[model samples]
Target: MYSIHRSFADNCMAVTAPVRSKGRFTIGCDIIEADKLSNRLVALLPKTLDLRAANAVRLGLRELLINAVEHGCLEVGFELKSKIAESDDYLQFLLERQKLPEYRLRTVQVEYEIRPQRIVFRITDGGKGFDHKHRTHKAREDDALAHLAHGRGIKMSLRIFDRVRYNTAGNSVTVLKKLA
Candidate 1:
């Protein structure tokens, strides 16, 4: 048995409903500006994770959100970010991009679902997306993560979460982690 509840506050509408899965319950959904991700995550994380697992989840979520904002919303590609990684101007570039009306207005939608066994996150960004298929696998080589400026996040998420899936368009990702 499941139920749905909806409410509106501060011009934001939140819907909480259950997924078809037997134990799954939708907690809440939020649409946050790219710039507000850090603050939002900082506030919600403690409630979402046990202290033992908090660090890994925090790292994975941070990486994904950053990718959604910088790469997806702001249209920063791998080559561009990689070049910026080699310079000291990356933060300046990001700040400039964040100030753009087009980028500033873009948002990432996050949906949270809780199950007796696990918690699931569905994060979608208002951007064209990327080629996530190529990055799904764990790197077999020990050195693959050594110098990479990007992509380690997905790999880390794969290790931390029981499952991580990306939509075909790559604009959305669903990650599942078992409850402690």
Candidate 2:
């Protein structure tokens, strides 16, 4: 049996469930501030996690969260290009985004479920969604750019997760990583 309890912290609502068995654990659903979600996640990571795996998870989560914040929530796609450009070019690009005031009201929902076998993370945002089918197909078909800096987060996520799926609207991603 699962019991649900609702609470609030840091200006966000949370639903939490406590597991009754040794192998099972806690499940948490939270609506978080987009700007601080990554820091909260980084603080929550278990100390015993494998260094490489933990790093990959951290990087992937950070990038996705940033994408959701800067692009999805703020409707600022040009900010992403700044991340990929040369230092001088990036600085100029960032300056442009900084002048816009559309970044004020963005938020994201981050859900976490911890079980004995794996950890599941779901991140959802409010924004104009994308075409999941097209993105998935493109990732699978592109091989010549294996080591390219672009889209590395999605690639790393596919490799690390036991299962990964996106919501129909493409605004949410669910990832499962088996415990080592």
Candidate 3:
């Protein structure tokens, strides 16, 4: 038997009881301020996954969560991020944005569920959502677009997750990967 604990702001905590051999299970959920995410958060996942899958989850979740923090919460759009990437001012911009009251107060909510066949995650960010349909549908893998940097995260998410679906407003995303 094992349990997973998730800590949120204000010292709040959520704990998942020992998982059973049931068909599906709702593990736990957590809320973290957009600016507060870190690599250490990866430890929040259960040890149920093997090394390779765990690494994939860490990388995929980090990218998507950072997208939520940077794009969804901080309102850094594609064009601006592209320019920042070229100028190598992204770190500075992130620092400045972290101080903004509006962006500072926003949060990202994450929910996790374990099922007999897969693991599901629902991640939502505080921001005016975008056109998820257009973004996901029109994303092309041609050489021209592949050479760009901004869309790589989304492209990577598409390939990594068994399924990746975004809300109509695009502020929320649900991803799942098979567990075996």
Candidate 4:
């Protein structure tokens, strides 16, 4: 589903907080920031969860980070995103957006903790938020929108995490997963 999305975050260093503790980091609107951060955070996670579960978390985490960068930081709406996803130069288009003054300085903030019983993540973006309540939650294989590139991230996050809570302003999201 995210085949074209792979190159956006290749071979970049992540800005991260300390390991094995609660930490916070911020990233720019550009694409590399999302993938790098997710890989770094997953490396810092405890090893108790089975490999399958860990992989799920990794995939979901990356998706959420991408969502924040695309929708929140870069202000790319669903309709425009749908159009962009079908194009060959999706990453180039996103990079072009980052060059714009309005989006150049926008950022996404991530706060997280590695706890014994659960993991908590708070992802906040600087752009004006939307009505998150109106966003889709289901990503069924039969769903046409879910088959698209842009809409699956939030659905993946909601499916993999125990809880996903978005702020009233929709700029921030907090996700929790029990470790048992």
Best by lDDT: 4
lDDT of 2: 0.55
At residue 145, give the lDDT of candidate 1: 73
Residues 92-164, candidate 4, lDDT per residue (tens digit)?
9999998899999889999999777888999999878877777743443446564565687777887899999
Candidate 3, 110-146: lDDT as tens digits: 7777655677778788889888776676554544358
By TM-score, how accurate is candidate 4? Answer: 0.84
Model 2, position 145: C-alpha lDDT score: 43
- Candidate 1 lDDT over 1-180, as tens digits, reads 112111112112222223222221111112133324433332343243444475466567767777777777788887898889788788778878877887777777767666656767777887898888775644434557767766577777777878888999999898888865
Each model's TM-score?
0.72, 0.64, 0.74, 0.84
Deviation in Å, model 3, residue 67 alpha carbon: 0.6
lDDT score, residue 148, model 2?
Answer: 52
Q: Pick the candidate with the highest TM-score.
A: 4
Note the Cα lDDT for every prediction shown: 0.62, 0.55, 0.65, 0.78
Q: Which residue runs of candidate 1 sit more than 4 Å off their true CA positions?
A: 1-49, 138-142
lDDT ranking from best candidate downward: 4, 3, 1, 2
Over 4 Å off in model 3, which ranges?
Answer: 1-48, 140-144
